[model samples]
Target: MIPTLILLGLVFGRWWRSSLMAAAVGWPVVLVATDVMSIEVGLLGASALATMNAAVGVVVHQMILRMTRQLRPAGSSRSGA
Candidate 1:
């Protein structure tokens, strides 16, 4: 899920959009998995977990982007004129 979200975010060029998509994709799966396993997780608990997962995914994605940007030198494209 984290990888998918990050890839989609990169593809779409929008971090928040990817984050939202992660929540949309994750909610139903989590709910159904818990149901199938007969795990008693309430709505609030499931929602909280999903939210946290999305938040962490977004933060990690942003950190990677920041690090990549920092690695590039500022004058790389400029010719020695």
Candidate 2:
């Protein structure tokens, strides 16, 4: 789940989209897994957890991107100029 969220964050490159996708993907599994809670409760809980995890993933992805950008050589250029 963690890896999936991180991958989504990196792939999507947007926090909101990654969070929404995480919630959508997690909600069904959570709804089915916890018999102790009502559907509504499960949904809320799952959505919250998914959103938080995705946010963290997005932060991690952004940090990695920043670090990589900083590490690149100043002379490197994508353009032929």
My TM-score estimates for the predictions, one after another, are 0.52, 0.58
Estimate, for each residue in 1-81, the C-alpha lDDT of model 1 and write its tens digit. Answer: 445544544444445665655665566566677674343546556555555666666666677778988997887754656
Instruction: Report model 2's TM-score to 2 decimal places.
Output: 0.58
Residue by residue across 8-38, what tens digits does model 2's lDDT show? 6666555657466756666556656866445
Highest TM-score, which number?
Answer: 2
lDDT of 1 at 28: 51
TM-score of 1: 0.52
